[model samples]
Target: MVAGEKIETREERIPLWKLKLDPTNVRFSHLPGPLSDKELEDEIWKENETRDLMKSIQAAKGLIEPPFVMEGDGYYIIKEGNRRVVALRKLKEAVDNGEIDDFPASYFDKIPCEIIPKKIDPIRMDIMLAVWHVSGKKEWDALNKASHIFKMHRDKGLTYDIIAEYIGVSKSTIKRALLAYEECQRFLKKYPNDPVGIKRFTYFDEFFKKSYLVQKATVDRSFRDKFMEWLAAGKFRTHRDVRVLPDILEDTDATKELEKGTIEDALNTLYRKYPDRGDPLWETIASAVEVLRSMPRSEVKAILEDQAKRHLFSNLVSEVDTLKAELNRIRNGRSSKLK
Candidate 1:
């Protein structure tokens, strides 16, 4: 039940059998298993993350937070605690089988849940999912969160302002999420199941999140199509290479250099022509690493002395520790081989 809503609400200890997995859960669709297993998952179980939760609950002897839900059709549709519910179900089964000596029916029989009346609107339920998933505790991945907002707006006919208010994000953010998902569907149509290309979903988020990049793609369909074609064909090797596209669009000389087929040569041309135009964060980090390899001690000290810059320098020191361990392990392996 919504804590502040006027609707009827009460905490109940419901048997695990009555709590069905919300089939509409965004994460539910992506479980890696056979179709039968996937189907059974919504009705019976969960995999991956739920496994970790199952162990935690078994150790804790009970769930920490009650699942919030509303009755739907025949079962309680979980709004906030899907992972916890799945974890409890696993614990219940273990107790039934006497597989664990300590866990018994008393510990697993009925789980706490906050329930709302069955008459609540389903779209409101979607917004509740958004509150927890978008900015709240159980944050979904970028693409997952984007897809839900797009669906709610496109399919459910919710206005951007209404959705924005419900989810507590700006309308512009909602627009970017929609754009990102639309691009994902379009990209998938071409590649279908190419993991190498699909792995670039983060790049998609990075590309769309920038208002400038999206603005160019919007006004010039040809530019948008050609740029994405580069991504699908693997012409661009890294996300930074893709991210640099919008900036290149502003420079015809740079664009021509990039079209010559090497991201490095293109970026070098951009940097040389426009000395201030730098790569985004990761590229900057990579460049910083290269500089650090040959940089003077004076430069490093100056950077570390600045309070705002100390954290990354400190992180680099920790990385050096990991590198030391790796070097020692390699040396030990070689010594054993020689023996």
Candidate 2:
């Protein structure tokens, strides 16, 4: 990794774990999503870290995983790390593009670090971004926050699964929250029009982003009164399930059919047979149907193969050889009878 050492191209198949680090050629993925805002905000710490990193680079001259590069010549931002990379880029771009009129005192020391071309390694970068969002601390907090509200409503005689999705969390999480909400009756109230209000609350993104306690105290207070009134009337307590009307114009025909209960008996029978296959299952099946509807005849086999692999249902995949063998066996039995 020294100045005399060779730099390898992307095509080189060095095991990802084996990269040597050098100050000159050391690589790190600079995607925005991976960096937390706090890490990016600290200028002094970053400078010291960079300086120490360079010293290490001069000593070990080893390559770590080649820095993750994004598009063009800049580091690709996945989420949290964008600030750091962006800070570096802003300085570099200003200096290199001659955009700077009055260079700051720190500019001289920082400009060299900013020289990294902002290039995104698309494939790995995308996977990393998805991984961070799902597995990151921030997303977990958001999910937990949404789940708290969802459960609270459920304990006050609301159905949780449907309510959960409106707030952006899984049904199971909503179920867990209901247990806690039930015990927090001292803090909660009931309302007559609370369901409608709760429905409206879905549009309030600000409420969902905060901690559960903050949300319950500040945002839900007005609605809590309505919930208590509604409880006295027993409207929510008696309600079996909530049904939302479809907003799409194309769905008018289906909606009418559903309202008339022409399909009700059949729908009930289907549900009884497969109780676990709810709306979620229908959503998946509908998506699959849409894919099949758009597929061309020539691509059907390829599509089937892809589906089989994804579903792990390769046993259901039929090849021409199996069909031919079945046909041959039938033909041979007929020929022997004829003879």
Candidate 3:
């Protein structure tokens, strides 16, 4: 594509076998969760959604959603709709072999494609692809998203402003994404032989935003590595846990204090502030009050509905009243003495 020139695009039917997946598609090649690129791509073909799409194509006698393509390296590189291209190819194979009752090879032989100029602008293509995959329906996971940003800026020499403008995000956001992405890369380098999947590393992206927690983790190498181990083992979970982690790091004697026996114990230690002790009685009272303070009305009502707990609450109220009366009597005695 020529700069300042209008990109001309036209639709045509292309042979199913000729179209190939584009390696440059940052979205299509990267798969979320634990699946590798090829594994996820192969798995997409086996999905029920893919099968449904094939049946629809067979019914319509053509593919309505034309896969975008541009001529490169002697073949039409599939810029988008790689999955659809794969599905069509798979459908053609099935048809040629008469795998289904009614579908035929002739019906699956060709499909619609939107062909563009051979030399489409790489920057323009990247921007369009980024928007569709990043913000559009097909959302890439945080891992892939950061990796894409890092790659574009580092390897391709694209400026942060250019990337941010196209993706419609702030430059600072892109910077943080790159930092967190690099953090994950550092982790991969250290544990090159570990069996843990790469997707788990993106979970640390949140920590980069958390300076207090991340600082301690980074400054203290052992603590940092241990926390990353917890991450790899899938122990660090829940929004509550993430929030309290820095607190544990700041106030506690050790990070292990945060990793209590069970999840419930961990939560109680975090919420109740155990071992990271304060004024003992006040801490106990404060912990109880915190639980009550955060408890929803529905949960409070459910607890109060139980007869034993209701009786206990009434006793607590009586104790509070008695305390108030004793305090009042002491105040009256002091006043009388002064008079």
Best-fitting candidate, scored by TM-score: 1
The lDDT per prediction is 0.74, 0.37, 0.69
Using lDDT as the measure, which candidate wins? 1
List model 3 lDDT by residue over 152-243, tens digit each: 78877889888887777889778878877676666777766545546544556777667787677667868667766666555665424555
Per-residue lDDT of 1-339 in model 2, one digit per residue for the tens?
111232232322222112212211101221223444344334323555554554443344233323333222222222223223334444544555677545553443321111122343322332233233333432423323433343335333445553443344567655544433342232233332344433222222322223452345356676444333423333332222212111211245543444444334324444454443446776676677687679776676665668755454344335446878999999999999999
- Candidate order (TM-score): 1, 3, 2
Per-model TM against the reference: 0.67, 0.20, 0.66
- For candidate 3, list the clashing residue pairs, or say none: 1-119, 1-120
* Shift in Å, residue 27, candidate 1: 2.7
101-194 per-residue lDDT for model 1 (tens digits): 7965677778889997677676766777788889788899887798788778888898999888867899988887887777767777776765
How many clashes show up in model 3? 2
TM-score: which is higher, 1 or 2?
Answer: 1
Quality of model 1 by C-alpha lDDT = 0.74
**Worst 10 contiguous positions by lDDT, candidate 1:** 29-38
